[model samples]
Target chain A: MIKNVYDDEVPKVVTIKETVIETPTVKTFIFPFEITEDIHPGQFVMVWDLNNEKPMTISVIDKKNNLMGITVRKAGPFTENMYENMGVGDKIGIRGPYGHGYELSGYKKVLAVGGGSGIASLAPLLSFYDNVDLISAASTKDELVFVEKFKKENIQVHECTDDGSYGFKGFSTELADELLKTGDYDIIVGCGPEIMSYKLLELSQKYDIDCQLALDRYMKCGLGICGQCCIDDTGYRVCVEGPVFDKEQLGQLSEFGKYRRDAAGSIVEY
Target chain B: MLKSNILGMNLKNPLFLAAGILGTTASSMKMVARAGAGGIVTKSFSLEANDGYENPTIVKIEGGVINSVGLASPGVEAKKEELIELEDIRDETPVIASIYGDSEDVFCEVAQRTKDYVDAFELNVSCPHAKCGFGSNIGEDPEMTYNIVSSVKDSIKDVPIIVKLTPNVTDITEIAKASQEAGADALTLINSVGPGLRIDYQTGKPILNNVLGGIAGPMIKPIALKCVYNTYKTVDIPIFGVGGIKDYKDVLEFMYAGASLLQIGTSIMYDGPEIFKNITDDLSIFLEENGYNNVTEIIGLSHEL
Candidate 1:
């Protein structure tokens, strides 16, 4: 079985078996990984390309086919490189299904909110969670991810767009606000920009529903060894204690939605 | 009781969160302090922000890791902002700013800018992988070590000064003695050992972006012990022993080898930040079993043998 990956082993090289264009800027690369029972949603893996190593969330985990996927949004030099150059049959080194993934057990109904590329992080949960209402929101209809994939699973999807070209025309938070007034969701899970997660946190509190957020920060050494992604106030390592944190846990982080450190550890106002 | 006094800071125990790992930020350092480390030594920073190397700057090997983080820092000015947040925790869990530079002037400048926020300065002149003659280049030579330490000591006085030495030198004691004579309050024996390599069989390329990086973790413990042991015999200053320390047994060996205190790095990757409390708890039990009242009593006991 593929157990919890530690840094002790060299990154396992896997060839891309399939590739799908999820959006105008987003693409999903599929590969056959053996015994991926250890990987979980919200947890990320360090993808080693020809040039460098970066952390990407596990988007698709198919146990039966033993296939895994990473949905990449073309952002920055590394991902832009992946968009322009990386393709099927290309060998990429992958280590870990690392860090804390979302814990959605015990809850009956889950209201999942994914903004833009963040749907990639929430996709693994859609397979595990039976009762899920996903609000897939984006700048435009073409920028949305994983809507059809969720529909194929009979998962209810609420499509949201900013320009009114889709079903629900508004911010994901606005659509989620309307849903919360009627939907009896026990838990509200969010993955997106810190601003979107922040709004989701507020909505969860407004409805008194439990909330979990998958946050993004500068990450290196997907293992907790490097303090690159550590958060404020509590000093919790985002690489270990989180990538996923509950509403109460999010309350401890003062830097959330306000700022985050760069590669130089200098604060950049968001 | 694990309470001890060394380097003028009243520490609850002898264990410190070593520099170079998890010492990157104020929040992270605060996390280690809360995890029960007696002191926090920050990752080395300098006058200008350094991006370090590209991707794959670190890789896992047999016993530990080879890291080429390239001394990535936000410069002393930006780093001072992080350190300012640490100042509140300084009285309880003392913060040690680990600073490095290309020359003595930069070293002293960094120490001067940060002396207010930190309880001590760990001069990381021994980082084996840093480029541009910054890390071990200055630490390997006794005269250069003296120049930096003395210059830093001259610029600052209230805070303790620590020179973290590299083991790749001909005789570590020469550098240790130079640090002591130059007014360093203490010494930290050994940064990571060799600028080692781990080549990918598929691509035939080194795993680290820098190709070579310093080796750290369990394999280097004995080497660290010996460095601390030999330097202990030559210098009067207390030594902060670090290298592949995983548990309480390693802690005891370091104390016996003449380290008055300890720092745990690298192994924090294997275990979590909880390594501090785990080792300290086991150490307390070990001390109780041995009829020791204070951990200080065990320091340098191996010397008499």
Candidate 2:
């Protein structure tokens, strides 16, 4: 029998923490650790937005001054609740910096491609790898996030929208394809819509550029023990072993770009 | 000064943290040491890299938990960093490395690789919820159990080895004796029970990602005690009893049932990391009040009846 690693007690709140919203549906949450600790860019926190029954993975936009910032997109019930109810100085339970993260060494030039809310998870990496070229996409011009945030760093911001309201009237894929054609980047890191990542990974592979994709699988316990966020492959778990997996590894899984599974391994497509 | 032993390596205290739950890293292991645990065993790592199962692998059941963690690990090579770091912690706490493998060769290889870092070794032959060809399959059979344990014993000459057993077997005593004869130094009995499943009535489906899981915590205490009780009658080697033990009373029951030392597992999940301090403090009180000078006096006290 598999042993259960149980830690269910929710820590009581002493003070509420807050993050400023960059867009109407997108906001960043700042968590100052009670204990002094170091967190990396790719490692995520299991944010238990009290209104929901389970925890959700919010991106760590930055970890400095002993505080970790999570960027969230209001898409589902959990995010909606978090957007409406959560504010600065409102406390919520946060556990983890769990799972393997992007190997931030050996690469010279890198590109970060994010779609919609996916840009939040990649912001920290951009800060870490200052040389990164960031391409962000949304459905419309108003939806474009982090434009000012990236401008502060003087990094190149390539924006794309479906309705041609922004810099490019296409998707991040078109921008990424143009960048890949330059043959200057050593690595391509992406997170966002599955199709966007899938297209970027394919393009990277064609150019023989190393690519890493962070997948958003359903999770319960952020620990590897919970099998809720398993990528369908031989011995792959997104929560523990990853949220970040190699593009080659992602290519091997059949359900890489489609629906996800619940606790029972039942696939539910979005 | 706190002389005790498991497998064969002399331990200062019998209170080693069980595998998987809290043994993932050196910091966590160091935290366990600081919390007053005598020793620490690492979460089981496999020879090859395994992502194991996905999230929601564990869930709460009444009195305990039903979990199908699928033995997620960072693979052996990556885990060496954590093992090496344990040497730096300023404690004489003997580190026991718990490892799992599909075959005898893998066990032997990992033993050889990790032998220098740890004081002793635990071949996890009894993970109840492991997939076929891994955990319980090797543990349930006398010959297979013997092979896995003996192979490690042959490879690691200096360190003592403990073959952990699962209670799911119909006759655990036979497997215990087989491990002893095959060169096992001691035995750690009862590595969780039941590839049990809990279904959520509201969802009309199972709660865990893997529908079936191993049951631990208070629910398996009686069965684990029974396994230790039955094995005592057949094996002469000292037993390291573990299962559903939450306090000094539970530890005492194992000692009376024939366990020389005890391991605390699932309770740490329910009670928090302070469980080690709680158990030891309670034990100190229980020992002084019971007119017992030392813990050894109570081993197999139940057999006197």
Candidate 3:
């Protein structure tokens, strides 16, 4: 009857309560019962679809009604299978709520930026901060997700699309840079592509604002054991030390936006 | 119940975290020690910082994993920071530094730099995917193994030296004997096997970024056991057996095969850090049930027949 996911390595089988298609490529899966472990906004959980296991950020955590949700984009073989084979009531394996999440306790005013499916990890931060600004970006208006949801949460929203099909015409990082100059926020947080995060880190340094970022890397184990997710030079495992890191820590990374290793540990251009 | 002594260092148990897994950082290694490991063998490091290989360093096969991480390290100076962090646990939990280099001078230099920070040294002469002349290249030759181990041994007499050997060699016992004759206090058998390859069905490209990588997991357990068994018969020093250990049954098999201490690597990914605690508990129970006084009783029992 142990409730903590970290107590066991084997994944728990949970029934899919519902599925909300946020965009053509992204969907939020709802599980019936709350995983009793305390989970934070930016932390993630590993989803085992029998074929493979991949980490997905926990997009929604509803503790009161016994519900938890993970937002996933159809990125590869594993996610593609999730979109095609999974349905309401279908049993899937899940473990974790792993890694450190966003720490927003002391900040007075905060701005959060997310690009594409990266928005999923930043969505829950809105609940923790009363004075917050959020930017959701995608390639096009049709692909921009959670806009209506953020609006409903009474937070200010800025939507960006690459094709000029949405609110801002440029990339989300450009918009974030503009905001950094105009706003007097004490803290900034972001999740998205590495390029966007790298830009945000630069802006944070330029604006003298503390910034935290959620990173993605190739990981076999969500725990810190596997060195696959380690960042070059720093040797920090994104699975353990991060997935969420602040400005000071992100500064030490040499490969920030330039490159990333593929599944085979071969470096590829980011 | 699992307590044992290897190379004059007292361990609470025979299970130690193998080199190159979670031992990259002090905090991570400390976490594993807190979880129940008796000692920690750090990820192999060299004199200069190396970026190692690009991703796709590791891939999953049916029963194990292949990795070509290329021994990515932050060099001896940066690694010293992590070793300093482990200094507090040097008394209760032994910290063994695993170092590698291309020549005897390089090996001696790394050992000399790190000797003060750790309880012992593990010469990583066995990494299958390491660049030419560094890992198995130095270990595959008896004279090379003797030269590297003797050089390292000469540099640090205060701490015991354990030479990690490769199984890809023609005869592992020959290399083991060479290391022992060269004054190595202990030996860690079978650093991953093969320059194994896997392919992406769609791309028709090799799965590992390096094209070929060292293999480790349950599938290599039998081979590792045989290596340890044969080497134990050839050498007098304690053997540190590693490769494909997942549970207590594997631990017993290794112990009975003449491994004085055991190292768990790939299984830590599948079972998490809890694997240490779980295996120790099961081993304690197994010892009591079988009327064994301690873990040392089973060492080399398989050779009795």
Model 2 per-residue lDDT tens digits across residues A136-240: 899998887777777876767888998898888888888888988885998898888888888888888888989988888766565443334656533355766
Residue A4 lDDT (model 1): 24
Q: Model 2 chain B, TM?
A: 0.96
By lDDT, the best candidate is 1
Predicted structure with the largest TM-score when compared to the true one: 1
From the highest lDDT down, the ranking of the candidates is 1, 3, 2
Considering just chain B, what TM-score does every model have? 0.98, 0.96, 0.98
The C-alpha TM-scores of every prediction are 0.97, 0.61, 0.67
**Candidate 3 residue spans exceeding 4 A from truth:** A1-224, A228-237, A240-270
- List residue ranges in candidate 2 displaced over 4 A: A1-54, A57-270, B1-10
* Residue-level error in angstroms, candidate 1, position A154: 4.9
Candidate 1 residues lying further than 4 Å off, grouped into runs, are A1-7, A151-155
**Fraction of the true interface contacts (Cα pairs closer than 8 Å across chains) found in each model:** 0.59, 0.05, 0.10
**Highest DockQ: which candidate?**
1
- Residue B249's lDDT within candidate 1 is 90
True contacts kept of 2: 0.05
lDDT tens digits, residues B116-199, model 1? Answer: 888889999999998868999999999999999999999998999999999998899999999999999999998999988877
